[model samples]
Target: MFVWLTQFILFRLAFGMALLLSTDLLASKQLALNSQTADFPVVSYCVDPDWLPYEAIRNNQHVGMSFDYMTYIGVLAEINFSLIKTESWSETLDKLKNGECQVASMLNRSPEREKYLLFTRPFFVGANVLVSNVDQPFLQGYENIGEQVLGTVANYRQAEYIKNYYPNIKLKLVDTELAGLKSLASGDIDLFVGSLLSINAQIQKSGFSNLRIAGIAEPQDILGMGVANGDQVLLKKLDTAIAQLPEWVHVDIYKQWNNVRVIDEIDPRYIFGGIGVFICLIIIGIWWQLIIRRYNGKLVAKNSQLQALQNELVEKNRRLEFMSMRDPLTSMFNRHFMQDRVEQEKQVSLRTNVPLCLILIDIDYFKAVNDQHGHVVGDLVLQEIATIVCSTIRDMDVAARWGGEEFIVLCPNSNLDDAIKLANRLKDAVSGFDFNTVGHLTCSFGVAQHYAKESFVEWFDRADKALYTAKDTGRNTIIAAK
Candidate 1:
């Protein structure tokens, strides 16, 4: 029995040793396969040659957020990137289209780009802002941009979006963001749209204190790397690398580039002077106490005067607040005030499951009137139209001067059909009303109801399209969006 047991133990030991050796061989084979798979060919990449804080080609070297992200991703994926120089973003896009470059370091994905490139998942997201001269009033939104000559970078996603949605806005395309900003600073363009980071960086670098952010624009910048559509393998590798990236790495890179510090140092002389002033105040307080009884009547009169000044100051502030939310000529709500009201009403409509609608009105041939009758007469015409619109709509509805020769109405608890009816009434009122010197004028209207879960921009876009259709078909008409 002892000899039989010893033979069984020996058999078990041999079997275990063979299984361990097989497992080791399989692991070694997998390691070799992985190493071979990581050996990818060098990639040629292009960047916006002038965009800073995001990506740029400076002195023939690639630098900025894109560079840092690609460096880490390349190390992880075992790929190499070679810089392909270009003079401008437009040129960079041209090179990518013609296959001169295999990748774009950072750009927003667009339908036109999808024809030739495959985009990786977005790695960086930032807001887009409207920039204008310091003297310009705060813009309500892009939908109210009117006929201003807006500047945008050539080949930028924003340029395409504005062209497709807000066709009324006159776009002046520049080669780069820097060029566009410079143009804006020089008053060559009314406004410029760009990513917040790049805009801030350029403004600081160039000391463009004359320019200020007017307002936030629709559609934030969602940026990702783009690879040539033909290179599926490279695209897959890049996607995997981006997915494997740590969240901390993103925060770190953003901080490294965007961190702004303001250091305020106090001079010792100022500190000493402040101390001396405090001491003098204490001595003065003691002296004043001795004279307090003698000056009681004077103090009472002085306090009365101060109180009257405070009352006047309060009244002025109230008037200022009212003026801020109103168009001076029309005495109606301005676009800035209406934007906030629309957001609030939208939220209420969503929460209560009630209906919300918007109507856009444009004065037909209004510019002709301005040219023929001059701006003073044109102002009177606008004021009259505003009054007619106010009288035509219900008190629950909100109206605002959308921009030059344009206005918007927001209706709560109203459906498309009801909104269309309201717009018709407004159109008829404006058509029948007579401007004293300008004679009779007509208006075009576009009406749209908010769809469930749709964004403000989408709703506004539908209405804007309808308004354009009304103009195209003929003036003095109302059209409802489907």
Candidate 2:
């Protein structure tokens, strides 16, 4: 009996070992194929760990809309799957570059990203929306939201859009949609802005009775997946998978998220009748005089409050119009706005018979910094140089972005000496500063004092010509038109 038992135990151990070996072999195969398949052959599927209704991990298992979609693809292709989860968007992107993760799910389709990543046919449609508490007054439209603080995710494209176009509207950024909703509930933010479906699912799961899903805004953008560049096979497979999904499936998904509550405007005749009936009912009460006086007082207060808000809105609009002329990156007047100012300056220059000078500044090797350090650091360098230049120039002088990595300054009523001096100061200041990862850098400047009979193009050409001279002479110097 003892000999028989020993033999059975050995057989069981062998079987278990074989099973383990098979599992490891499948996993290894999946990893190998993920790496060898494209330019970025090693695809890492990077996803936010805590984001629910879109992508999330629950009980150590990847799950959500995107997770389900990926899982389906893996099964259909008969490939064993290995999923990687990341807590931050940047880490996901890093993993893809480091050959750790090969694919990013549910990214916005953008022409700019096409340079580095391969995109699949869109699997789903998403719309940006404004979400608010149920207890608050319903949003008839975005305009009705007024100056309420809108919450959005940090480092998100939508945040940048709102920042640029609606500067007067209050914007608050949290790291995640969960945090955005938390801020809204805590009164830190008035409304949370995000993808309608994702935010709706989150709100539903939170079980926050007071919170509500407001009407979705017009979809400003769409979301899609990104694979590492040159993954044509994977891209084609994704396209096929998406095409296979029936139209009803998409409709069902949309139906689940279209939780936006809309209120219909009351008919004018009904409103008038209702108000008259309420007045008559109050008049017939025992304390009729007192009721009427209190009612009128409340109406007056509400009217005055609305009037004040209207005036404030008008003022905010005026400020927005003024700020529209400014660049968000540099806080200087932007190129198009500067053109209008230049025309005005031309009128003034002609009236006073004074010269109008132009200086064109280009940061040397700006693209190199971007390639070496990253776009974020390059943006910081541009901001730093803009600050230095703005500080060096007189208040009357106009500085503006003349396209990428180039700045144009219009010096009205200033001749060659003033332009050259200012240009030299700018060159020195930019060269002296160490730009974080980029380190110390320099800029080239071309200074041109206008000739009385010169056309705008002629004056600009002279400045541009001098700029080339500065570049040719080795950058970090100022060149003035002779």
Candidate 3:
């Protein structure tokens, strides 16, 4: 009986999958018919002549995963792809830009490329990795490559990203992934970046025993065929073809190129034995169900009580977590939370080469306010100042009550000038506000931009010294750390 049930389940699954495939094929056929009616011309395509496993040109023929995918897509769309070979990837880009080729066989989409090409849906996705000499330490990611000379393929998206976002790092451009790896092996470049697939393929093909994967890169690769700008009809057809391609076809092509073994069939004897075991388990489950039913009511009541207790504990834990991170008086983030956030922001600043700034603001004459007006009024003054600080700073800035009568604001992506301007605005807001019973109060600010490779303790010390200067020069003024 279990054997029969297993067979019935497999039949149903196969039938559903068949119906889905039939629907996809019918849609693909309609697209083909449309292309036939339109008389879509043969597409002249270009490819990186050296990139392998993903794509390459050899013996005057297109090859690799992109070639296989395009071959299948061309048949489904009733179109043809004619190879327009180039000697290098740079030449391929020129061909696409010059209209020598109507399609780029595979590439990542970028704003610069978008000017000359219309991209189809991504047909291949893979993570990128950092490659370095085997003696190098394992880096966490691209963000940790401080001061290292990084090499990337010229005109590749990774090079573009590093230039645009991480300009502080020295960049060395190579003509190909193989060249980059060779450069690293010879100690000419400190690191190289490329997609995991092509990187592995090149390392293995070139027998580069000295190179190792140092770390994962920032963004994963999203590759698709690029149609030349103004080729809307070809773009639409390619998109449809890619979307309709069967999942198994993609799996098969990937496995073939990656040298992964494919099992064609499962053993019938194992299937029968598995079904017999399942039947035995079902019989035991039915017997167990009868015993469980005898105590079902009692178990249900106990479960309800346990659920109520669990809910209460979860609520209590949430409140505890909130209390731990927040100041009770001002309801602002406490020092502990700010410490963690500052560390995270500093790492981001280092990684992206973006500027970060810190502003240390101290309420002036706070001890006098408490001594003169009592702690209740002092508490209200703190709350009112917190409100002003929140209102004065941009939403991206994080403000925390840094112990009694002091606060800290962490400004990400802000330079020294911008941070000082923000600090002045905050100081003005505090001095102008009426505290009711306390009348008017003022705040002194010390603003400092984070220096590259500076420790958190050193960064904070600079800001603190500037605050002392502000207090000495006269309270309620802003002083920027030099």
Candidate 4:
């Protein structure tokens, strides 16, 4: 019995390791593929006409979270997308089914749809909510959805899930959320079932002041990108692109659509399992005390081995965390890390009445460095500049590579004047540095101070415009945005 228990525990441990290893391998594959150009130059996708906040077509242009997500994917994969416009939400599905378009973004998985559509792994998740007239009592679940008609956009997977799981709920198919909300407000339906964020946006925009959230209903769907039937090539391509993205990429996109921030998740099942294992081991130790003469040395050796394994796992996790937050070439913090720090510092500044400042730095005529001296020398110049900025900044300040030829510095307790001074210091540092073979390099600087009630993006944009002003006037200079 003891031997079997030991084998079972070992098997669980090995299974956990295999899961982590497989995940790492998948991410590595995504990285490998994302760094290269995709087989297709362009891929077209069908767009829903009025699925606001997640996707919509406005004035012939695709807009919202899914559009932003796929745009990033296209940029990384070196592919282009032409969003094929459809007349209605139902039409969007038909376009993909009939192969009128090759891709559809944020498509929920369904067994019926799977027959004609290939789906990538779910890249985002959101819950289905019931929106109803403000007079309606808050609904807790779909099971309570009795004889009253439940309004929903036609062909929505949310509606489909309801049909499959709770067939008794009367469904009223509508072309859009606007119509559904109108119908509900007029006593034509009990509730409208859709994405919580989307329903809220529609209510606010269309003057559905009479409508309110009846309650959040569940079976939160995992959303994925879908391609035409048997389009494994495109499906795999999208999956790889999504896998290659950092967690912050998804966070940024979600932030644009929803006011709420997504919290990092922990697997409670594993957590509880770990606690159970600890308790089991304690009981085993009590048993072992009776057989100390036979088991003391074996237990000690086993515990030592376990301690070593724990240390090794911790070290590996530390290295991975560091690597994820930094730019490999420059050895500087990357935008992901910078964004997180800015958010933290911004909240602190707001709470304490302390000033926060941002500086945007851009390489002046950097393309010339790559064009004339080759990318190797260009990279070296970037590395050298990163080192200078790292050395010049105060220990309390944070710096990060924002993007190609651009960097940012965050000053936690500094005002506009202080930020300008720091920018000038960094500007001087870069200008004075000897590039060995590449010669001297200069950078343009932009400074901006945060203001009450302004968003993080707004603050960043102000500084970015300042950087542009410096570039327009000349290369090596500073500009402060008002």
Candidate 5:
């Protein structure tokens, strides 16, 4: 899946004919298979008409790698993706935001878009590279761009990345990659950086034989399809359809455009950027050909196999994400999740006009146990406490080990009395439980009800003090903030 998407994203950068060819009238291929299927949805979407290799509109038709991939997905799912006419990428984005378009293609995920768009799993990784005239060699180090005028698409995130991070670089903002290349060709801008495929396409059309890739940029882009936030049904259907296509189609479609080469296992975001990794992987996986042939022979069996793989992939990704949010030692929610989830839970209570509570617990004399039983037994005690707390608390309550032997719980829709009761219950449970020949142990707990208009830290501080009171007054007890 990664190979196909990466190939899907960078496939336009194919060497040789792609570099030499100027006009092939690139457009999406329509599929006639399984049109009679009943579950097919007629999805309305808009594409960026000027973004080549990824998407483009030439002679009034939606075309490019993105459109072709979607058309193939439509065939697999028996859906009709009706294209909505739009003038530019900005207009396409506006249509999506305004609900005129139900879907938008080739979207990069970011913090801002989450408010309006639900992004699907990324379809491919984009390795953005600098494009300059061959005569003017440039370095990949971002510092080299300090004194140069860089041409980039206006309102594009890359423009923002450059402006915000490298303010020293003079920006020559253009409306499209073609415009950027044009600006570069005219020497109006020192150089331009864009998707490898996009710059190559523009270079082929510009008749600029001197145009060559200058350098690859950091943080390679991840491209995904987006539906308006809250449109889960459409998003699920689209993801499922896209996942079912034979992986080779991702590579095959690109091969028709240009010859590709792989560089390394590069994410560009974190490591050395590798080109043509997908092609190399595809070459090595010869057995998949039998499955592909069988799929072509029998759609039902192939669909079943693809669906199984899709489920497995989804499950694995979910588990990985879930595992990342926990403390490995105690199998409790980690401090990182505590920080984020507390904010989320606070917002939920505020939105619903309900009370929230926080409880902080510290294992009394935890150091003594570690000193006597050793670190291994101390770890076991923490794990056992986590299990006891999780099982004793309400299902809606969240539990986390803040640090060391101190555990915190976030209780939604609970008031002072309710929180105190639960905290006392937790304290008693800890006091009663046996610790595998390590003898008995007690915990100090502080409980506080959230007050309206109070900051999270303020409320937490109150609870934390009450917990220390538990420690000072006596262990194995709960104290609620007065």
Candidate 6:
């Protein structure tokens, strides 16, 4: 019974091509034995007119790989089918399912639509690939794509696939594939994920030389055509027609659409750059050997002096960079950086009418800890405490070491109550954390909400006063400013 039920479902899911084969066309050998049983020979098919290489109407003429294949099938079956063009893929699918259109060309098959339609044996197999602007360097692959923002068609399989695994990649879903392509060309997105064939064709038509393929997506089931689910007779007919097609049909289709060349790997600049660097290294090595062989005491001393100066310069640059907006020892944003960030947050909150809150945290009995543990251990504790605070804050929230043992957290769009609750959570998280060799630690925090007329510094002073109150009244507690 299970086998019979499966067979019944499979048959109903296929096309109605069997009805066409059994007509008078079959008596004349024009139609196959598995052709559809329809009379009067009325056939209707749906195609996405804007999709290139696969299906598109250009200059009042419809020509595409799928269109040609369907035409070949029509000629063999002696069926006169009316071509129905739709602007969107979803609309075309709707036409097919509603019986307004009997065939849909070039659709991917997946579980989402399996219950509603039958898929043909795949006519062509291709991959979704990354496309980038011509001036930009090609991405290494999806693995190295975190820094880039990608654009793609909404509801396309590539977008869904990326969202499933590459959650860190920034994705902007456009209305259509062409919109995604245009966004890539306009620099709206660093990369666009689309079909290799279709994107290449669109690029050629638009005369876009700067756009190129970055990488290809893994082929999967989401790429195929859809037919009404109850069309078992049609499925057998289409399957028979597909099996009988010339082996060269696939090759011909590919050749007809092969205009865009996909770059399967990285650009030559890096490759050439690496070779140049290696040659330089070899030359330097030979020079170093010669200098060693002809060693003069004075020149050797000069070389050592020059090396020391170069090291000093490098160290100076490193220190300068480290000190820019950061406390070097704790690796937290310095007071200057915190002030600028808070000012920006205040302006944004004023303009958008959004709530903003600030939390001032101080290490409880920090001076006592320094006296007992030595300044070196106190420095370690500060570093450990900074790490704890940074880890506990949300990505959108900003945490900075305001100065010395005090740190500030800027929470945007958070109200007074939410800020108080979050302050308590952070206090708890810090208290519960085991700081390894540092042993038990606690912090006192002052939380304050922003008022519309208050300046960034004004709001911070309120939070700061609360911190002093927490320290005075007793440590290890959170106080909210009135």
The better candidate by lDDT, 4 or 6, is 4
Q: After superposition, how far is residue 390 of candidate 2 from its true place, in Å?
A: 57
Error of 5 at 240 (Å): 2.4
- lDDT (Cα, tens digit) per residue for candidate 5, span 170-289: 888889888787777777887788776566556544445446566666435567788874587777777676655555566666664433222224246433212344454478676755
Which candidate has the top score in lDDT?
3
Clashes of each: 0, 6, 0, 0, 5, 25
Ranking by TM-score: 3, 1, 5, 4, 6, 2
What does candidate 4's lDDT look like per residue over 1-482, in tens digits?
23322432353353334433545643443344433434437788887778878888898777788876775576445566767888887788878888989988777767678778876656776656777675566576787767878988778877777788888888888887788888988989877887766766665455454565666566555677888967766766786778675575587777667643222355598689668766766889766455654555775675565445444433433344345467988989888667756765675576458899998999999999999989998888888888899999996688999988999999978999998899889988889888878888899999999998788899999999988999999879999999
List TM-scores for all candidates, in order.
0.48, 0.41, 0.49, 0.46, 0.47, 0.44
Candidate 1 C-alpha lDDT tens digits along 1-482 = 23322432353343334433545542343244334433546788899888888888887777789987886566456566778898888889899999999999999877688788877766786767788886566676697678788999878999888888888889999988889999998989999998777877776556565676777776667688988846867877887778666666687778777743222355698778668756765889767555655566775675565445444433433444445567988999888767756765675577458899999999999999989989999998999999999999996798999899999999988998899899888888888887899888999999999998888889999999999999999888899998
Q: Mark the regions of model 6 whose C-alpha exceeds 4 Å error after superposition.
A: 1-40, 59-61, 134-141, 164-168, 220-224, 259-482
Question: Each model's C-alpha lDDT?
Answer: 0.78, 0.67, 0.78, 0.74, 0.71, 0.68
Off by over 4 Å in 3: 1-40, 260-482
Provide C-alpha RMSD values for all models, in order. 21.2, 23.0, 18.3, 26.5, 16.9, 22.3
In candidate 1, clashing pairs total 0
> Over 4 Å off in model 5, which ranges?
1-39, 134-138, 259-482
* lDDT sort, best first: 3, 1, 4, 5, 6, 2
Better of 2 and 3 by lDDT: 3
Better of 5 and 6 by lDDT: 5
Could you give candidate 2's per-residue lDDT for residues 45-102 as a string of tens digits? Answer: 7776665567777776666666645643442343334568677766666776665766
**Which portions of model 1 show Cα errors greater than 4 Å?**
1-38, 135-137, 260-482
**Model 3 weakest 10-residue run by lDDT:** 1-10
- TM-score of predicted model 6? 0.44
